[model samples]
Each structure stands twice: as C-alpha cells, then as structure tokens.
Target: MQGAPGKRIAWLPTLVAKRQDTLRAGHLRFAREAPWSGVLHCFVLDCSGSMLGGQRLALAKGLLIALFDRAGASRAEAALVCFGGAGADLRFGPAVPRWWNERWLRPVGGGGGTPLASGVRQAAQVLELSARRKPAQQRWLWILTDGRSSDQPVRPRHADEVVFVDFERAAIRLGRCRTLADAWGAALFAPDELIA
Candidate 1:
C-alpha cells in the first residue's frame, strides 16, 4: 500500500482508485474493448439535376453530416453514395465516420441524371461486403431523393432495413419514392425528420 509518500490502496472498485481528495492515475486500468452491435446507415443521396436549384442537395448533405455525427456518437458505422447522370459514386464508405462534416461534404456537388437504382445497388454492394465481415451487424439503406428517376427500383440484398426519404415538393408529385418503398417494404420519411 506504500509506493510513494501519498500512494495508498484506496478501494479497488469500478476500475478506479480514489484517494482522500484526488483520483490518482495508477489504479485507472483499462479493460478490453466492448463489442459493438449496431446498424450501419448507408445514405444514398440523389445528386441529380432536379436537386440543383432548390438547395435540396445542400440540405441532404447537411442532414448526412448530422446523421454521421449521430452514427459516431452511437458507435455505429456510416456510408455515403452519390448518384447522378453517369452512375453512383461511393464518396464515403462502409467505414467509420472519421471525417464526416461540412468540409468532407462541401466537395460533393450535384448534377446529371438521377440514377436512384444505381445508388441503391452500389450501396448494396458495400453492404454485402460489410455483411461478410460483420455478419451480425444490421444494415440500413437511406435513399434521399425527389423520386424523379425513371430507372426501375431494385431492392438491395444486404440491406436489413430500408427508408426512402422523399425530397419531392411539386404540384404533380410522381410518388416514385412511395413506389420504391413499397418495392422494398421500407419506411418512408421526409427530409425534416432527420433534424427532428
């Protein structure tokens, strides 16, 4: 119980040692890392031409960063997939949200056609790989779009959960987002639900 002048065996509890008026560092020990059982949120953003003028893309990007923060706080993983005229691009990952903020999102621009199917498919591929590695991990696919794509919806294989966040706001709503959600048996949400 005596290594130095003030060193004493206080109490071996809660993995910490408390002396009279100070908490010394010697008794603060660390155990093994805890196992993580969390859902991986794969955000599929529609960076098409329709999302240009209204700042819909900007809103989506901001929401994505918030979601990233939420994922990090929850100790969950996150990914970002952007799709447009050409095809879907995996901007972020099936990786941890290490640098998911405004800085990382600023460079991601919107244009081209809305390849909704492509984005979902690309995110599904990432989910498949993640599934093989962390088989017990749950996967969520979040599609942020205005439902303007003419491409047929194809449900991704590895997504355990799905949500279609409709960004549409027009007189004659095409309701393609509802169609996709129906196809996947997923929940439907508006963009504002994120902030809430």
Candidate 2:
C-alpha cells in the first residue's frame, strides 16, 4: 500500500476462474505488473520558408537541442525528423543522444514549402518501428512548426502522446498548429512557452 498504484496487488480471482480447471492454472499471483518502462521522445520540426523569417527556425532548432538535453537528463530515448519542401528527413535518430551538442543540430537548414503532413507521417513510421522493438515504451511526439503550411492535418498512429509547438507570428494567424493538435487531440504550446 505504500508503493506506487501500479505496484498494488489483487487476487484477480475472476480472471483465474475464467481459465479451465487445471493444475497449471491453479497458481494465484497477486502482484501487478505495468507494461510501460520508459518514454521515447520524438521531435518533428518544420523547416519551411515561412519559418525562415523572424528566426522561427532558429528558435525551433534551439528548443529541439534543449529538449534533447532534457530527454537525456530523464534517461529517455530521443529522435528527430525535419520536414520542408516536399518530404521529411529522419535527421538524427530513434536512439539516445549520448554525445549531443549544437553541432548535431547545426546542419538542419530551412527554406521551402511546409510539408507538415509528411513530417507527421514519417514520425509515425519511426514510432511504429520503435514500438515493435520496444513494446512497452511510451512514445511522445513533439511537433515544432510555424503552422503556415497548407498541408492537411495528419495524426500520428503510433504516438502515445503528441504536443504541437506553434511558431506562427502575424496580425492574423493561420492556426494550422491548433488545427493539427485538435485533430489528434494533442496538447498545444506557443514558442514562447519553450522557456518554461
């Protein structure tokens, strides 16, 4: 009773009774075993021309590097996907960044049409592959974009949780990030919130 809720034990008599009468099924185990062990932090960054102005891309890159630091501190696996123009690239990894640095993120260039859908689709594939290898790992998708793209909202299939970071700045916003977040029922955050 003094441990985590996940560590609680129950007789589960009904579950045992559901089994056929046999010596092998006679044991009554009580300890609860949660399936998840840790989380995989997946970052999907939009590097479109729209983000080039106002240093949005630079902000996103900075935020991503910081997030990798946080993930490393938490002992979580980290991955990166950058999208622009026509497609998405799995730029970094679906692995932990043992030696992470600004150099690793410096090469992510931006300036083209926003392929937000492609980014989400590619991240979904990465998450799916990781899910197969680590069945108990929770996957968290972090999307950083200016939300200026015309691409339709695409919800990732394998992500256990999704967060959309909107970078759009203008008198009248497109709100594409909010739309995508709503489509996936994900949490939304502004670029300014990166500090907190």
Candidate 3:
C-alpha cells in the first residue's frame, strides 16, 4: 500500500491500523480486485423466420447493441447464442468485449425455424462453463425472442437471474414468453417495456 497508486484503499484495514498504533503507509491495505468484477450476461437470441416478419430480429439486434454497450461500460462479460435454422451456436464470448459496436451484429441474418430448446441448451452449456470458471460471478440469462417456437426447455440451473424479453407483437398472441418466464420464476418484459 505504500506506493500502490490508483488502487482503492481498504478503509477498514486502514482504520484498524490507526487504532493499533501510529498510522503508517506500510500498514494500509489496498482493496483487492472484485471477486468477479461484474456479471456475465448471456444473451440467447432467436433468428427465426417469424422474427423477420415484423422486423423483430432487427429490434432484437438493436437491443443487443445497447446491451453490449452497457456491458462494456460496466466491464461485464457477455456471450451470445443464436438459435434458428435447426441449431444454436455461440457468437460472442464469456470475456468482456473490449471493443463493441453495432457493426458486429449487422451480419447476423435471420430465417428458418426457431430452435428454442437448442438455444437454451447451448446457453446453458456456456453458463455452466462460466460458473465453473468464475464461481463468484453472477450469471444472468437473457432470451430475446418472439415466442414463436414450441420448444420449452428447462431453465439453466447455473443462471443466478433470468430475463425473457418478449418481442411478440402479433394480433394472436402466443404468450409463450410470459409462460416461460413464469415457469422459470424469472422476469418478463416486452421490448417496449424495457425501453420505457
């Protein structure tokens, strides 16, 4: 602590040292880095044909950009799992995005059937791996979809929190997103609700 500049001072350690004897720079303790730094935000996006009908996929992409920006600002780790066209795949990372921009999401095309279960399973694997790597870190699972798929996968056990961002805006609502959120005991919000 004597010459450790730019480090946050541990006030408790400093106070204890002051009470013990005359304050000395050697007795001061600088706070160690945070256990996990920030949360791991794993986003599972649906790139099904249905999402393209009303520009839902585009909206989801916009949200992803905003979220990525926020994650960068918060120094949080992020990962992306895209599901559609028969499978799911990880697109981003478990590491912090040092450089994030909307251009990165531009090439994410959308079409085909929604493989909701596949997406959840893929994201679950990512979350499990992250949990093993950083046990102290909080894990948040975010599913951005239109509730167009019939697949209802079990919630990932490792996720500390879950959020379903429903993009469904059809006249005949499926409400699957709400149901899934309810079943998982997670938060449910519409795309508009999130911005509002």
lDDT per residue as tens, model 3, 76-167: 89999999998999999987987988888899999999999999999999999988988888788999999999898999999977888999
Q: For model 1, what is the C-alpha lDDT against the true structure?
A: 0.77
Clash numbers, per candidate: 1, 0, 0
Poorest 10 consecutive residues of model 3 by lDDT? 11-20
Candidate 2, residue 35: the lDDT equals 34
Question: What TM-score, to 2 decimals, does candidate 3 have?
Answer: 0.81
Summarize candidate 1's per-residue lDDT along 60-158 as a digit string, tens digits. 888888888877766678988999888998988777886667998888888888887788889989899889988878787888899998888678888
Best by TM-score: 3
Candidate 2 lDDT over 91-185, as tens digits, reads 87887788888998788898889888899888999999989999888788999998888788567778877888889887798888888788887
Query: Which candidate has the highest lDDT of all?
Result: 3
Ranking of models by lDDT: 3, 2, 1
Shift in Å, residue 71, candidate 3: 0.7
TM per prediction: 0.80, 0.81, 0.81
RMSD of candidate 2 to the truth, in angstroms, is 11.5
Predictions in order: lDDT: 0.77, 0.78, 0.84
- What is residue 72's positional error in candidate 2, in angstroms? 0.6
By TM-score, is 2 or 3 better?
3
Which residue pairs collide, candidate 1?
Answer: 85-113
